[model samples]
Target: MSFRFLPDDPVASIKLRPGQTVMVDPSARRGGSCLEVLEGVARVYCPCEETEGMTLAFLQEGDQVRTDRLCSEGICVEALTPLSFRSDAEPQEGVGFDSVNEWTLQLLRIRHLGNAELRLHALLALLVNRLGRRCGQWCDLPFRITHDRIGELIGSTRVTSTRLISKLRNSDQLDTPSGDNNLRLSAALIESAPVLG
Candidate 1:
C-alpha cells in the first residue's frame, strides 16, 4: 500500500507516529535516495542559501522529494501527523516530482521576491490549493498553522503574520470552524488571489 507512492520502484516503507522526525542524508557511496509521505502531513526543512538558514516546505500524502546526488547538508523531515513514508536508494522513475518541485520553487520565489502582503496571500492560496479539501463553498485547510509557521513561510515576523491573519479574518477572507484547527477559506477569497487560481 505504501509503495503506491513510488510505483514500480524498489523501496522500503516505515511508519512514523505524530511528532516523529527523520533525517535524510544522501551520499554517493550509498547512492541517491527519495522520501515520500504515504500518509499524513510532513514538514521538510532544508538549508536555504538565500536566507542563509533553514526553510520549511510542507508535504502531504503522495508528495515526495529526492536527491540524485550527494546531499552535503541533508534535509530534516518531521511528521505533522501519523505518517507512513518510504526511502529508496535506487533512482526513482515516474515519481511525482514535477508538481512538488514547482510548488517549492513558487514558494521560494515568493519568499525571496514578494512583498509581505503578497507573500502572505500566496502562501494562503497555496495551502488551499495543495492541502485543502472541499467543504461546501469553502476549502478546509487541515492543519494547525501558527502565526510563526505563517511567518516562516512568508519570510516575515510572527507579529506581521498575526496582523495579516487578523486583517484577513476581519475582511471575511479566512475563517475557522468552531472547535477545529482546520481553516476554512472562502471561495471568494480563493478566487481573489491570482496565486491560488
Candidate 2:
C-alpha cells in the first residue's frame, strides 16, 4: 500500500506491512513538515522516474526525514520491517544533522575501500554499529537485508555478496537462522572492522 502526506492533516500516523511503500509528496506536505519513524525500520529511496528506487537510507525508531529537503519528485519509504511513522512532525531549528546524508556518506566511504571484502566488512560494521545491538557473543541486527541489497550497498555483484556472506558463515562470523529474519555477526568480526575504528 502507499500513502501521501496530506496538508489537511496537521499530524498523521501511518503503519505499513513489510515490503509496502509510502510516497511523501513534497508538494502536498505542509512547510516544515517531517516524517518521524515511530517503530521498526524503513528503507527510504528516490521516487523520481529517472532515479526511482535508488536506496538513500535506512531509518529506524526516532529517525526523522525532513520533507523540506526532499527533491521535487519527493521520496518513497518502504517497510523493511513492520513500520510506523508520523507524517507531521514539528520542524526543528538548527538540528544540523541529516541521517540520510550521513548514511550516504558512510556507504560512499565503504565503496571506496580497496577491496570488495573490506567494503563488505565495513558495510556490515556500519549497519551493526548504527542499527544492531550486542547480545552476549554476537551483534544482532533486527532485520535481514537481501544479498542483492548488500551488494548494491557495497558496490559488488550479488554473486560476490553471496560468496562473501558464505565465507563469513563458514568462518563463524555471521549467522542466519532458518526460521528467523534477523542476522547475527560475531563480536570479534565487528570489532575487527577497520572502517569504524
Give the number of the best model, judged by lDDT.
2
Predict model 1's lDDT versus the native. 0.68
Runs of candidate 1 exceeding 4 Å displacement: 1-11, 47-53, 89-91, 94-100, 112-114
lDDT of 1 at 91: 44
- The collision pairs in model 2 are none
Residue 64, model 2, lDDT: 88
Models 1 onward score TM values of 0.77, 0.90
lDDT of 2 at 42: 92
Q: What is the C-alpha lDDT profile of model 1 across 1-197, one tens digit per residue? A: 01111233435777776556665554422444566677888777664355433544778876767655324766666666678877763445776454446666877877864588888877787777777877777878876677887887889999999999999899887897788767888877776665532
lDDT of 2 by residue, 43-134 (tens): 88887667536678889998888888888988888888899888877765677888888877777788899989999898888888998999
